[model samples]
Target: DPAEAVPAIAPTTVEEVNTRFVVLAELYEHDIQDFHALLEGHEAGDERYAERVDISARAVKERETA
Candidate 1:
């Protein structure tokens, strides 16, 4: 009876894992673009960057929920 275990095919190919990685990489690019845009029109050392940082932080938090 111990010899009747079902067999499963795990992702043993590089293509499969690479496809998943590509999708994640795309999401990361989009997030970074959004972050950069948030900081646009603001100068360095400006307090306005705090608002942008808060927005980016909230976005990251929301992404964690997803």
Candidate 2:
């Protein structure tokens, strides 16, 4: 799953900023788990699935640091 959270603008208000963070946090949490499950289900012969799992894992890592 692709996860993205975009506010109407650059989160100027306190509430909008907080909401954006909340949305991002939720997305990060869910995507990490979803990608892990996808990795677990990938078959040995499925090179494309393996590649995606690898890419997704890296994306999760990047999001974690961001």
**Highest TM-score model number:** 1
For model 2, the superposed segments whose C-alpha errors exceed 4 Å read 1-11, 43-66
List clashing residue pairs in candidate 1: none
lDDT of 2 by residue, 1-66 (tens): 234464344438888889989999999999999998888667544987788999999999999999
Question: How far off is model 2, as Cα RMSD?
Answer: 21.0
Worst lDDT run of 10 residues, candidate 2, spans: 1-10
Compared with the true structure, what per-residue lDDT tens digits does model 1 show for residues 1-66?
665786666756888889989999999999999888777645454667788999999999999999
Mind sharing the TM-score for model 2? Answer: 0.44
In order of appearance, the predictions have TM-scores of: 0.45, 0.44
The alpha-carbon lDDT assigned to residue 31 of candidate 2 equals 100
List CA RMSD, all candidates: 16.3, 21.0
Model 1 error, position 28 (Å): 0.5
